[model samples]
Target chain A: MVTISCRDLDVDLGGRRVLSAIDLDFAAGALVGVIGPNGAGKSTLARAMLNLVPTAGGSVAIDGAELVGLAPSHVARRVAYLPQGQEIHWPLSVERLVGLGRLPHLAPFSRIGPVDQAAIESAMAQTGTLPLRERIATELSGGERARVMLARALATEAPALIVDEPLASLDPGHQIEVMALLAARARAGGLVLVILHDLAAAARYCDRLVLLHHGRVVGDGAAGDVLSDAALDAVYGISAWRGEAEGAPLFVPLRRRD
Target chain B: MSLLLPLLLMFALLSGLLSIAVGPAHIGLPAMVAAIEGKGDPIVRAILLDLRLPRAILGLVVGAMLGAGGAALQGYLRNPLAEPAILGISSTAALGAVIAIYFKLADTYSWLVPLFAVIGAVLALIPLLALSARGESALTLILAGVALSTLAGAGISLALNLAPNPFAAMEITSWLLGSLEDRSFKDVLIAAPCVAIGLALLLGQGRALDALSLGEDGARSLGTDLRRTRLQMLAGIAIGVGGAVAVSGAIGFVGLIVPHLVRPLTDRSPSAVLLPSAVAGALLLTTADIAVRLVPTAMPLKLGVLTALVGVPFFVRHLLRERRLW
Candidate 1:
């Protein structure tokens, strides 16, 4: 089992303190959703965990191994990160695009051998991107591209996965599928942390939710505990419609609170 | 990609041989081989060894440098339009050579021309790199390159205007047009080392370039060092193109067009196309040099002229398609 712990972690972007003295712990085999309104430092916390952003204070450790000063490849090997947006620069085939995830594992001059090949195939299968392997990723539809990108991250076969804002701009069906995939990954004994906006989806699928507001974690616990009306009003200035559908609890933002 | 690589190699080898065998006086294959095995007539050996052989080898090496340099730049900047010439590197290197020629600096050290050219290429790269470091658009970086090219052009013109005599001015003009004509083994030795260093640096970036296809953030997350990659790539361009310009006088377009020609066969993966593009560049340049020798004209058509003649149409088509990038 793997664990990521952040102790009083602080992050600085430009000259501003974007993340301040944040403490959190993530254990394996759980689906944790990080939810916040825009500019609430949800992304910053994720970045700080991976050491992608500059950390000004405190420490991050993966299974008690200090994450700071770790090489990016080393970090990538232990944790797969799928950054926000569907921005692909080249018109590479989906197979090659996904194969790129094996980069941190392979020697610099070495070709992708049978082991890497199996991983590539497995990731594609997991994401249902096997049939789209030959298609150019840039030309793929939004849902398909999202899946392919997730496949690229999965190809790393990392035990810990962090994806940022994955549901944005995807259709509702695709959004549901994406969330289900994250939950399934967690169920299969992996740590899956996702930054998402859909509170209902998070409530339905996520085992836990961490709420952020203005560079600080306001609440962390089960959806019922963290998505309380008072927390919602203070953090997002909105009220959530807490109810149930298909025997699953749903939390929908009802209205903006002044 | 596997099938395409050998095919490109075959074409490059054939063109290299053609470059050696099909010069102004056709030294047939048998004669060329005999001369190499130390059995041909002495004059034939001199023509083959002292002249055509070096020229042919230089063509292959310089052409490969241009091609590889283009591929590396295109891959890093993620733009099909990037090449040493368009990025102002070639022009700055040419300015270095012109300065060496104008000041008669080569009369003593003889290697000073190429060394200065390498320096010039590096000098031009500094500003371009600085602009890119500020997170400017590719268009802005390219425009900065254009400005550098214009400045180098003005510098070359100053050298031309202050030429000691008409003969010296004519030599500068011909050299600026670029050719492998009359270049000896010494030229090859001087250029090959620098080119070799540069090519090694560029070709080494294969994995990093592949990772970079996912954009800067994506590549970084995949363990690619974007900063180190950019610096190494820029250094490779400067040193490689510097050596090439010192010898061949800034041959253009081979770097730009060869990648376009070869990309389709490599699944368009930027890294996968690097080697094929280099080989294809060697083939195209060697053939073009041979054509200049065979094509009847009052004066031999400049290799740069031929390359631009061929390369401009491709550039125009690419611009039209990628105009949205600007």
Candidate 2:
């Protein structure tokens, strides 16, 4: 188990501040959904945690170890990231693509061992991508490709998983399926932070919701507490109709705020 | 894919052997075998051991370098069209060789031309890397390469214009056409170390290149050091292609064509394409060299000329087939 903590994190991109003075802590065994309107720096926050983007100030650490000071391979062993764009440049088979997740674990010249193979198989099985292992990744449907990419991330078996916009191209069924998989991963003692645009799904599946507007966290806590009507209107510029369905929380954007 | 690698290696070996056998002074297989055993006629032995063998070896080495360099560049840039020549390294090296020839340096020092050419190749990478360091896209990189190539082409033309005599000018022109003819073991020795170092660097990057196929951010997330990878790739291409151009002049398209032809056979994995592409490149150049010898032209056709003739058409066809990508 790992705890990812960020203190006053700031990021600047091309002279524009994308994220500013952000502080958060992600404990293991929770599915945290980062939700915001477009251009709220959701992707930037995720990238900043991984040190993929240059941080202007402040510190992000995993279990009190500075993330920026660690070697990329070391950080990768602790945190696995699934970028927003699902880019597979080559026509590599699904199995080979997922096997890339084993990179940080394997030595430079060593082949994939039995333990690595088991992790890869388990990841594929969990993501329902085992059946498409031999198929070319580039040829897959958007939903299937997203699952394959998710499997690639899961194959890392890192303590912290940061996924951005995972439900963008997925259908309704696949979206819930992916959300359930992420929730299950958290239940199984992994820290899963996913960025979701769908508020309903975000509330339904995530144990905690981080609502951001223009790079600052406006709401963060349990799903019900964070998705309050006033908070939704203030941050999202919309009113949401909240109700309970089958003992699970449900939220639908009702109208744009005047 | 496993079978393809061995087959390509076998074909490259056969082509190299054929190149050694089919020169103007035909040392038949029996005589060649005797020469190998150190028991052939002195004349046949001298011709086979001194002339044809070095030329064949040079062709094989230069071809392999370009091919592997091409694959490595393509994989790093994540663009199928990326090659040694695309980034202006070859032309810059050619310019260096031409300047050496124009200054009569080639006459005074046999090694001066290749030495300058290697310097030129390494120098050309400076701007290419500087542009990429600013986080330029692939299109920007290609555009920068075009500008650099044009600048180097102008430099070559200036060197040609400043030649001491028409005969010197003519010599520079033909040399620019690129050939493996009359190369000695000395030439082989000169280029081998740099090419070997470059190939080792490129080959070691297989796993990193595989990670990069997921795009830059994805690769970074997977623990790839993009900056380090970029540096290694730039240095590898510069050293490898520089060494090749130093010896063989400007051989075009071998780098571009070989990788594409062999990619499918390698399951389209950029890392997996490297070795096979190198083998296929050696085979292509060796065959082209043999054809140059056998075609019975009044003047021997240049290897670069033949490759362009074949490669340009195939490239056009590829563009047409993948037109939607643009």
Candidate 3:
């Protein structure tokens, strides 16, 4: 199985040490959730893995290959990404936007063939966006746009998918639906790594949890083992209750007493 | 859809022939056909082959290059408003051309203008791109481009105002307004190769441009080398836009408008937008050239005026629409 491993990674952004000696491993066929407070360097970790930002020290390796040594097209074909800041230039149709996922696989002068079309259609269908294929992505609602972006990542059909705050701005129903989709993707033997701020959703959906506090990995293990009350209180400086709701783990953040 | 290329090719040929036939000399279709087959009168053949054909071909090449260059820039920068005109290349080239003209450099060496224009365009890109690429937002890049363009414009105006001869000032003014007037086959020969190579470079990077559209972070994660992509794009813009602006004198909007027009044909994929934009640009400039020749005027109409007249409305509509959305 393929795995993304980072060893003693440090990241500096705008002259600030956003992350310090970050060490972690993300394995295949796992729904790995990264939970952290604001400014905790979760996004920085994701960027470092993608090689979008340079590491001040140490290195990241994917499937035994150093990230720095791999070509972009090679990495692109194996790893699909969904960025947090989504901005589409034109009112491209849903099908058209999703079809872009095949870009890495196609030659520069080539057109989309039957295989590409099939992939596009499958991605749209997987995200339940087939009915909206003709609609413009820019005109879609926030949740719909998020789904469209997810479909773009799915269209890559990569073994590994990384999404940053995919549930942000999504409604509760759509959030659950998207989380279920991620879980299913992981179950089907694809790696799915997501950055999330919602502790309850992270507790309920992800099989494994990686928590960051001030750029260091505070906890890493199965969700049940890593997401204890003490850990939450220490990381967030707040009290929280953990329990079960409808056969799934549920987390409730207590209101501040002060 | 597959038929688009052949269809556009056919139109390009037809429009080209129509351009030769409709000028003041009024060479009919039969005469034009004979000229093509090399059976017409020598003068008629010379006019068609030597005079009109090169001008038409030059327009086509320059337009296609600019269009392709603009598409590449917008895709690479991930900004819709990015184009040669707005990004300072054209204006810098214009300033270079003005310098060439005012110093009587064009009189001594006709090729000096295009060469300096090219160098000036590349020079402008070096600083502008460096400033923008170093942790600047897309908006900041556009703003920087505007500032540079204004500086170039002011420089051109200063050069014109300080010219020693009245003829030089008039030439500079007319050139600044932009034209393809009195252009000969030699001008066409000079620009064709640069434009062709630039277009090839841009088209070669189509897949890279697609990756860029997904945003810098997304593109990076997808294995796109951002620095290399930026370098390729800058080189292509310098060659294509520099050559076009050197020859055509800052024709606007072909780059900005062509992609929006052909996007649907390629299903809005940036990778797909390159060639269709090239063809669309060729058609547009050829048609505009034909219009200038057809308009009944004692003096020839400037091609830039027509493009701006058409482009301004579209730009306004786009801005209004963008406002509504944002």
Judged by TM-score, which candidate is best? 2
lDDT for B143 (candidate 1):
81
Per model, kept true contacts as a fraction are 0.74, 0.79, 0.64
Scored against the true structure, residue A157 in model 2 reaches a CA lDDT of 90
Top-DockQ structure, candidate number? 2
Q: Per-prediction DockQ, in order?
A: 0.55, 0.64, 0.58
* lDDT (10s digit) by residue, model 1, range B1-326: 77998988998999998787876676777887899999978999999889988999999999999999888888887888788677788889999988988888878977787778878998987888887775524466678788988999999999999999998898788888889888888889978998999899999998888887777777878888777787788788888888888899878888988887787678788889888888888888899899888889997788989888877897688767754423
Q: Relative to the unseen true structure, what is the C-alpha lDDT of residue B23 in candidate 3, on a scale of 0 to 100?
A: 71
Query: Model 1, range A188-247, lDDT digits (tens) per residue?
Result: 999999998888888999999999888998999999999998898888889878888898
Better of 1 and 2 by DockQ: 2
TM-scores of chain A across the candidates, in order, are 0.96, 0.97, 0.96
Candidate 2's DockQ: 0.64
Residue-level lDDT of model 2, residues A1-258, one tens digit each, is 799998999999889888888999999999999999999999999989998888999989988899978999999899999998899988888999999999989898788899999999999998999999999898898999999999999999998999998998898888888999999989999999999899999999999999888888888998899988778878888998889998889889889988
Model 3, runs deviating above 4 Å: B29-41, B132-141, B264-266, B314-326
Clash pairs detected, candidate 2:
none
Q: What is the lDDT of every predicted structure here?
A: 0.86, 0.89, 0.81
Query: Residue A99: error of model 3 in Å?
Result: 2.1
Looking at model 1 chain B, report the run of 10 residues with the lowest lDDT sum. B132-141
